[model samples]
Target: MSERATPVKPTEEQEREQSRETERPSDGGADAAGPGPNADGATATEPVTTGAEAVVRALENAGVEYAFGVQGGAIMPVYDALFDSEIYHVTMAHEQGAAHAADAYGVVAGDPGVCLATSGPGATNLVTGIADADMDSDPVLALTGQVPTAFVGNDAFQETDTTGVTTPITKDNTFSSDPDRVGSDVSEAFALAREGRPGPTLVDLPKDVTNAVTDREPDEPRVPDTYHVQEEADPEIVEAAARRIEEAKKPAMLLGGGVIKGNASDVCREFAIEHEIPVITTMPGIGSFSEDHELSLEMAGMHGTGYANMAITHCDTLIAIGTRFDDRLTGGIETFAPDAEVIHVDIDPAEISKNIHADYPLVGDAATVVEQLREAVETSPKAKKWRAQCQQWKSDYSMAYEVPEDEPVQPQFVVEALDEATSDRAVVTTGVGQHQMWACQYWTFTEPRTWVSSHGLGTMGYGLPAAIGARLAADDDQEVVCIDGDGSFLMTIQELSVAVREDLDITVAVLNNEYIGMVRQWQDAFFEGRHSASDYHWMPEFDKLAEAFGAKGFRIDDYDEVADTIEAALAYDGPSVIDVHIDPQANVYPMVPSGGDNGQFALTEDQL
Candidate 1:
């Protein structure tokens, strides 16, 4: 039997303190305690500490290592406090870059990454990153400095409703007006950001509140009362799911990012191997299962491997673990796995039937549920023929691309070359577009958390900063590479300066096609080849741009120079950019048309 441990109940005194904290105003104000001795043996009348100090102390108590952001006028107080704290602050070139760096930091570090921004445009600039974190379910804490509390409603300079603006994008948002509650507010923000279905959380700190003095001691980090303790799936449900699997002729498993979030990759792999189940993953789920495994069907969806999509399309029973049936994975809802009976396991009950209906909805953490399912399930010979058939499909429809003999380089070849050079040991990050799809398809990931990208939001300008953050969080010798498209790289090109200043050894590989490649492909297929506003006209020279940012740059126009340039860029001690010109007319093949089923993929040029 799986251990069913419950959360420890709070003591009476602790309960009373929590109640008092809850009743405190959203606007910053004094706590219920007067100027007396506090629980930590410190007198309330003891030398008051600034709210900024208290915020730093709270983050320290919560075990945050780095804070990523650009220092601004309104947020200078926190920066001042950071000077005295143990936390390292990474100064990014832009607020959006900072937010993305924080998000990626959280992903690689396995903790909530913190970002600080000022009010008004500074806070607004973080919206894209915040939304990206929210969509991808990454835990990130965004701290925004606001105008003085007194001037909040007066339309003061740099004033904005930071909490109001971020409410929809964050798991929770708070406006702190009282210096006394800064510690508690920040602590809660960290907890909420990580608790159940992790996501971004925002805390709005008014400048006046940050400057205000407080006597409150920083509390030890504790699980928020609202957080639900994860439990193993019910025995009966696990048994029933096992029975369904035992009875099915063609059983398959679908993995997602949740498997990584729950740290269940090993157990998931064990279950798949034991049952001889073929595994397919979503975009963010790329590394959840080892691509080299025999049963691994790299990724299944639009732009997925032909064999993987075929497996998902033909499988009779699908055991979906921690994956939400998003539109990208499910080409068209009506035709997706039409004959399969899904046994869905997710931590969030709301996600169980939110998209595709689940025949067995087992609500628990992926690690716990997968373990229970493994224990309940018995080896069945029924799936032997099915596994053999899937293996044949994998051999027959393996991913393939043709390279022209001419000079123009193909983006797929670049990715394949990087894969060969890196040997799958480097942490790979990418911006959205054709480059992202190519990275997902070509790069073989053998470990979890090695592949990072903006999966759900599909945000461009994510690669550079995310690679910076990933490099900082990774081991000293781990190579970090960002494969970005020309259009995507330009979106956050300023981050090149941040990489140079930090002396991070990261390689940025730009597939420069001189056009919005993905958009151009769609236009070519559906818009009668009318390429309007898609071409770049060769505006900015990327190698020069990298050099201008104090980083080494190399341009590869000929196919002969691709391997050496990539190797040289990787060998550089500091940041470097390798701009390889790809065929402008090339397109990502094996594409399922919008609203089309997985079976409706256009594999060859004639099909398109």
Candidate 2:
């Protein structure tokens, strides 16, 4: 894989320079040249600039150093401009990779990630990733080049309504056929993506717009404050929610990814402590509640900690903050916490009661709403019984199944070894599968924003690229680990090159079970124990592949060596792969078969 010439490692002085550049006057005109008259009586025959230059210049002004995309016929001009400029462009094997990488980059960098593709199929391929960003409230700017304006809507070669296709999923979208509107439209798209309650946005640029000459002086785009959501909390609604909290016997806080997104964990913790309530988080919300906190119930729903699930099952009142109660967190929605009266708070109005019912729908920012709720709940006495019950549940169901032998080969053992070796400090990204579940179950995330995985999107091959993006975003001297399964690793295993060339300290921890673990588990529990197509018949020696990439590699068959190997991998200065072989029969327990309700979960091998 060819690498970019200049990696984005800015010094402190460079940071200061970038900051000053942001504050500098926004003159969009390309340094006074081209068709304009010169001070002397000489005619300048320089090439005329176009709207595409202005759009690209705005990206540079925003400190966008990289763009991910797969170039197509309609997008060739934009790609040409990008290559000619100082911005780095990464070619992706699949547009999904581009979109996901961009999404991860945004999450890690706290800015809008840029992605580009052409019309029709190329643009369609990015739909899933765009939707992922939309659902997660991630900041991503997706640009798709359209067919010539005159040829649009006639089913011209490679033409599709990219904006129309993305409008439902994107926070905002625009289509620009006029050459003059490209810069402002693209600037608006990027600004909208990074504003309050950030999300993905799209700008469809016609081919003619890219090639058309613009003699008019480019105006630096203005960023309006309208993109941010207003914080307007109704005192009456806050009091009603508080009164419900005050009157309840068993109240538990269901923390979602939204809490982290809104940076409302402090407020959440304040409310929890003030009201003496326990917290149960969703998979994406794993780190929102501190694991060290006495009142924290790590996770809730299918594959969640047993204590977390039971707390949700038994709680009398549920205060859901910054969460939409997705199916994974609810098991089956119909039977989830039938006794609890739900109080939902979110910035988006449509999310209040979309899936699960909310007894109190207070639409506002999580931080503001939670602060108000905290103020109202300042007088509630501590509920000793409720906290004690939650603690008992945590003590009972939260324990990990013991790896019986000194040479035991359990996924839990591998994850535990990695956790112990790493001290749970690094940002861990996981591919979607049984390994992902195991990481969620056994790996303790002590800090917020340290765990990244495909929770809602559930996309395979997310771990490696996500880890790569994370390391890039860290921009510091810190290690990142990609916990992957065999099936998921094979999806985009080519990303190993990215880690090697960039020399990122990323360890690929492959929990090799010789099977697609999740589907196999499903088959064993519900499909009458028939394995069918779930088995991975054969796999390459991953260690050899890692060595081929000019990186260190290790294969651990004995569980006793797991801890030492993980530590060694961490000590390595560059990327390394640790393939840990484990039992194929091992499956994450407390499984609720698809379509089954909460009580329908299988607890032990006897139930299986």
Candidate 3:
């Protein structure tokens, strides 16, 4: 039997008070831009610029370097303002692509990425991407056009409730009602997106508001006074947590996406290595710690490494940093970490015990709290034998697959070949599916901010657009590659045009299986082999489609063609596509059925 420790919880009254305090800013609203010249050097007396100009000026003041969007009627004025600005804007083929591109930019650039969309259909198109950002806690700012204030309720041609539609998915949203305050409203949204527990935020711009003339400038980006974040954990809690770590017979580190977002990856790596603690990364936390290190157990949860899941199940002290104990990672909560006392660290307090219970809840910035533990702990855990056991598990369940000369190409082989072809500075973006799992399982990620994908929302068609944004955000020397499934690649294939027009150097490899592979796999396992709408046999030749879009195209059908095709595609100066045909019946393994124990993951179909 495992011993459990109860965590302290705040009373209902105190919780209610804290909720009210966050909503009511101590300073009534954002500060006025003052009486002097705006960013364009135009004074209030001049009143020479439209509210649209102020909107673009606010972005300039926020140090926005790039924006992604699609042009439409209601948003044309803002686009006109953008035409004269220094910020580089990429006109995407679809609004969804625009939002995904901006989101990927945020993931790599470590700043709040910006996106724009017009009213109605345009606004709705961004919902998927916005929700993806919200679920993953990526910092992004979305500017959406709204119909004229007069026509809001009357249902004007392109009118929709942009703010209302996005309220649930955004960290915060505002309707720019006043011309003078519109710029400040955008500034506030940008600040809120990046300040505390980063997530996407939105600003809705009505036609009348942006069309009106306004010389008032925007306040510098700043969060509201009432929005305070705890920077350090309580000293007593840190000391206690440190003592627990010191006394641990088997300790393990679980790092999540927040480590990279909070700039805590370096500190996490140092702490884990110095103490010889085994490290397990969540799917989103793939690149937070180098997988090649001796103490690393790689990823944990459903499709995670066997050793990583073993460590989570058996460790005596679980140091979980920045993770929210997502269901996919925790499996059955009762079975998860049954033998361990969880030390949960996160910037957001609400996430501490919302999922699995936390024995030591260190609520603060990820890096700051880790530093506190570092200072408090005087001795490392005595886990030499435990470390040996973890290494043994790693050896027992190695990620290896066979490729015969007579059979079809294996997707895993293709992923490993791609990894061998790219430089270490390469950035990878993937759409959600079996291909996503193959890439995650095979690629050796060694740096922070290198792996980008749709984790929480699992949005398909994210790869191509994300590659476009990552290409723009990354250093010139860094390569951007999109690994996608056939079903996923077709959803937003129009984005290839944007890549070609911009002369972006990105390689796209579509692992073609002619089916909704993940769904098909589930049907085979649990649904009694009922493929039902999962077979996508009538798919277009993606390579030919790429050529039609004016990009270099290649095809790889057999094992001999793998390396050369990838090499040629990467050698292309502009955007390139490689359609790699793989075994249609192939399925990803090391999966735990939904809500199954992580320690009891299956390695093959029969086993499952």
Candidate 4:
């Protein structure tokens, strides 16, 4: 006899089945003769399966080797299944962190990253990260637990209508009403999240469905056609774009995240060099073009360098690739590149005229479009004036490192030291606000997708979890560093446990200033130091918190300690948190101060 596992204790409904087999459910029960054939020649399968088993089978079928999420009552079954399977689940401190981590994972892996969260608050907390992925078009799958289906509309404990809440945010949303279909739902969710115009997708599961048992067999998921994008780009549109580039005298390239997503960085760089044109990147496209390249200008828009903004404004022809012109980058659309004749090339057709109008719209894969552009530009004359203009701009506003000769430790110094120590090869994730902006300005990333941050969403507390995901996705030899603010670090500080549990040797450098630095900076600048209670002098010691979570911790008081602390953290086998105290009253200058006019910056007599 085949060795039968112990029968699961039946529910009261199943007890009635024991008395009369005929009264059992019609779908898949103990007495059903295999499965009935459906209209498509496929057999009708059981609709009841453990949520944990479904999660594992679905992930395996989706070819996902790992995911990141925190374990809670609603998500424990999925976690248990992950534990049993070959797949690794890196537990994190908060749901938003996991989502950001998933975004980073997608950036490096070039595939949809998966994240999980419990019901109610857990799902709600992931909204910001979801919105981030949505705005940036990052492929991410978020699984959330829900109260049992029977109690879904009753506001049961820890339950929320996650499907309803995430519907507008996600590309698609689904709830598991039947256990047998859970794997299929997950497969579709992953496919929809990754294919065509990538974004976030949600799959909500009920608590009881996770624990309940049924006569169900897991099967490999099939990829459906619904998720794929239209393959053809308009030939007429491509020809028009080629014509524009050939005729233009002052053409420039504006690279964005889509190039990275399409792995077209090499193609973009080649095109830029061949035409002798300048390349200005969005925040997401920082590492796409080498900072050392003469034709590569800094990022444009708010927080961008002055030279980049000026170059974009003066360019007669703009070749925008793989990016939507976000408002933050455009400074209110009307005044953005108004004089430039834009050639918008993107994989997503919806992004063509969503914000800024495009004179020549080329819709296709970024890599494919770059290849076409390369072919088209083979005969075009080199634009020497454009190259000279770009060089002059770079030379004019070359990123300056200004500091007092005998000043105490500055946040920029820490970033520079960390960059030097890591040989500038590490993937840096950052929390939102001024420190994040500082890292962007200070760090010189040499490779594409090296910086993982929530640019569009601007979510705080995104650094640690994103670093965790980056470490998992990147080469085993490379280190992952998190640049966090004291306020941001404390918000999701519990993620240290995940790093410890998984033995991920990641480092978090906390720029502590005993206050919410960004808000405090605003208060110091515009609000006249009203402060509004941004101080957190009584906050828990980060060193102690790291120790509590089974990781190493250190405090850096002197400038010399920055490199050593980072080195020690990188060398350690477990996670580490380094808390560095900076001047609490310091502010990030070059301030527009909200409502200020362009090119009007407050020059500080001395940068603190």
Residue 428, model 1: Cα distance from true site in angstroms: 0.6
Candidate 1, poorest ten consecutive residues by summed lDDT: 1-10
lDDT tens per residue, model 3, 1-608: 01111011113545424422332112221111222344677542343278888888889789887788987888877876775554557778999999999999999999898999999999999999999999999999999988888889898998889899999999999999898999889999999999879999999999889999887888889998899999899889899999999999999999999999999999999999889999999998989999889998999988888889999999999999999889989999999999999999999999998998999999999999999999888999999999999999999888888888889999999999999999887999999999999888899899988999999999999999999989878876788899999999999999999887766788999999999999999999999999999999999998998999999999999999999899999988888999999999889988988899999999999888
How many times do residue backbones clash in model 1?
3
Regions more than 4 Å wrong, model 1: 1-48
User: Please, what are the lDDT tens digits per residue for candidate 2 over residues 458-577?
Assistant: 888888877776666655544578899999888878878766755667789999998999999888777888999888969777888899988789998886688788888878877899
Candidate lDDT (C-alpha), each:
0.84, 0.76, 0.88, 0.75
Q: In candidate 2, how many clashes are counted? A: 0
Reference-based TM-score of each model: 0.91, 0.88, 0.92, 0.86
TM-score-better candidate, 1 vs 3: 3
Candidate 3 Cα RMSD after full superposition onto the native fold (Å): 11.1
Model 3 Cα shift for residue 30 (angstroms): 30
Residue-wise C-alpha lDDT for candidate 4, range 196-268, written one tens digit per residue: 7778988898877776774465445444665566544577777778777887777878999888877888989
lDDT of 1 at 353: 82
When sorted by TM-score, best at the front, the candidate numbers are 3, 1, 2, 4
